[model samples]
Target: MEMNGSQRIEASREQVYAALNDVEVLRQCIPGCDSIEKTSDTEMNAKVTLRVGPVKASFTGKVTLSDLDPPNGYTISGEGSGGMAGFAKGGARVVLVPDGEATMLNYAVSAEIGGKIAQLGSRLIDGTAKKLAGDFFSKFSQIVGPQPAGDDAPAAEVAEKKGWVGRLRDSL
Candidate 1:
């Protein structure tokens, strides 16, 4: 399957780029993510549970970041297996453009599945992928975007009080 879309984040390109690279931020943003651990600057391992159609399974995967351009963007790719449930692999090319104080995030995705999951039909699989992508970007934007008016806690202070995820959600 293939999909593409964009979002306007209420943050600078630098902030959005940094957050995209942060494993902790990704752990929170990804729907059904159990954990994400950074293995290297460009690699991560993740465990996620997903329900597609009537099949629910836990997936263990490795994600890689490539074609790096610092605050500009990068391509993210990954593949995972869920035993009899089947396997999935996909890649996304991401671009970040500065729009004044906000950043416009653009992405193009291509994915494929094999085994039992593929039998679920293209309509089901495509719908699931689109929903998952939307969920991920929406949460990511909310975390790294901007806080509402009258909220003035410094990020460090928020981190001290509520930890990294909270700080990212509330301050950064």
Candidate 2:
């Protein structure tokens, strides 16, 4: 399957680019992510649990970043296995453009799956992929992007309310 979309982040292109390369940022942004460890500057290993349709499984994956372009963008590719459940492989080209103080992020993604997971039908897989992508970007924006005005709650109180993501941001 293939999908593409864009988002306007309330941060500079440099901030967005740096956050995209940060392991902690990604760990927090990825839904169902158990952990992410950087093997190198351009490589990482991750464990995640996901549910598609009625199948729920844990996936271990390796991700690699290529085509370095600083604050512009890069290509990211990854593959993961879920034991008997299936395997998934995909790649995405991400681009970041400055929009005044904010950044406009664009991405084009292509993915494939095999084994029992593939049998779940394209509609199910496609929907799940879209949802996962949306979740990641939304969380990433919330973390790296600027907070809206008039929210003056203390960091401890806000973190408690926002859960792990908020706590992670506060720690950073």
Candidate 3:
């Protein structure tokens, strides 16, 4: 699956970038995330739990940031396993752009799963991923403050573009 989102943050570009890099902030921001800790400057570990259809499971994984352009952009990739349940791995490219008085936080994420999770089918996985992303940003905006311009059309477009299937399942 692929994902995209845009958030207007109250914090400055540097502050938002720093927060995005921080494991503590990310852990709190991620829906179902239990913990996140830095194992190294470029790598970190995370534990997240969620339910997809009838299956519920927890995942522990490692993530690493690559091709960083400090306070501007970078690619993050990670893989997590859930014992007999399944495994998930994905990468996301994040970019911070200045938009008038707010910083526009943009992300492009792609993810894949194997084992039981993949068997759940694409619709469930796609909706679940979309929900998770939406949950993360909704809370993130609360932390960053509100958008004064009041136009959220751009953000909605980004979210819709994430999936090829509009409703049940379209096509890629």
Error of 1 at 108 (Å): 0.5
How would you encode candidate 1's per-residue C-alpha lDDT over 1-172 as one tens digit per residue? Answer: 8999999999999999999999999999999999999999999999999999999988899999999998999999999988899898999999999999999999999988998889999999989998998899888987898764554546444566786787678754
lDDT winner between candidates 1 and 3: 1
lDDT of 2 at 168: 81
> How well is each residue in 1-172 modelled by candidate 3, as lDDT tens digits?
8888787887778878788787877877898899999999899998999899999999999999998887897899999998889999999999999877678989999998999989999999999998888888777766565544546756556556765556325433
Please identify which of the two predictions, 2 or 3, would achieve the higher lDDT against the true structure: 2
The C-alpha TM-scores of every prediction are 0.86, 0.88, 0.81
Clashing pairs in 1: none
The global C-alpha lDDT for each of the candidates, from Candidate 1 onward, is 0.91, 0.93, 0.85
Give candidate 3 regions above 4 Å deviation: 146-172
Ranking by TM-score: 2, 1, 3
TM-score of 1: 0.86
Please give the lDDT score for candidate 2: 0.93
Q: Give the number of the best model, judged by lDDT.
A: 2
Q: How many clashing pairs does model 2 include?
A: 0
Question: How many angstroms is residue 135 displaced in model 2 relative to the true structure, after the best TM-score fit?
Answer: 0.9
